[model samples]
Target: MNCPLISLKAGAVIFTVLWTAWMMWWSGAYSTANLVILAVCGAAVGYVWYRAMRWQFERMGMLPHKDDRSAQ
Candidate 1:
C-alpha cells in the first residue's frame, strides 16, 4: 500500500522539522544567532540522515526508485 504518511519524503520532512524544534527547545535560549545556527545545523544533519535512510530503505526494497512513477 502506498501511504503518504509513511513515505520517505514525508518521513524526512517530519523528522527534520521535529528534530529542529526539539533542538531549539532543548537549547533553552532563543537568540537570533542560535536560531540560525540551529536551523542550518539541523537541516544538514537532517539531510544526511535522510540520505542514509533512503539508501538503506532502497537496499531493503522498502523504497521505490526515483524513476518508478507507478510506485508513487
Candidate 2:
C-alpha cells in the first residue's frame, strides 16, 4: 500500500469536490435549498470518485495489503 499515492488521490478528490461545489454555487445561481442539494450531490460524486480510483489501483496491482500475500 502506497500511503503517499493514496493521500495524493484523496487530496485531489477533495480539491475537485470543493472546486466543483463552488463553481456550481457561483454559476447555478440557485436558492439555498438547491445549493444544499448540490452539496450533497458533490459529496456523493467525491465518494464515488475515490472508490473508483481505489478499485482501479487495486486492479492495477498498485495497492498493497498484508493479507494479499497470503492469498497468493
Candidate 3:
C-alpha cells in the first residue's frame, strides 16, 4: 500500500521497464544483460531514495505529504 520500500520497489520497476524499452528502441547496442544491469541500478537508486525519505519523514515527524500522493 503506502510503504516506503514498496513504493521504492515499484518506482524502480517502472523506471527499469521504461529505460529498457527506450534503450531497445533507440540503441542497437542494447542487450538483455544491459537491461538487467539497468534494472539493478534502478533498484539501488530506489532503495537509497526510500531510505533517505524514510529518515526525513521520521525526523520531521510527518509523512512526505499527507495530502499529496504524487510526492511519493
lDDT of 2 by residue, 3-70 (tens): 85669577767866796678686876787877777777777777777777767776777775447856
Q: Candidate 3 residues 10-45, lDDT tens each?
A: 765676566656755666656778767766765676
* Number of the candidate with higher lDDT, 2 or 3: 2
- Each prediction's Cα lDDT score? 0.81, 0.72, 0.64
The alpha-carbon deviation from the true structure for residue 59 of candidate 2, after best TM-score superposition, in angstroms, is 0.4
Best by lDDT, which number? 1
Best by TM-score: 1
Error of 3 at 70 (Å): 29
Give the winner by lDDT: 1 or 2.
Answer: 1
User: How well does candidate 3 score on lDDT at residue 68?
Assistant: 62
Q: Which stretches of candidate 1 lie over 4 Å from their true place?
A: 1-6, 64-72
lDDT of 3: 0.64
> Which stretches of candidate 2 lie above 4 Å from their native place?
1-9, 12-16, 22-27, 65-72
Please state the error at residue 32 of candidate 3 in Å: 1.2
Clashes of 1: 0
Q: Once all C-alphas are superposed, what RMSD does model 2 give against the true structure? A: 3.6
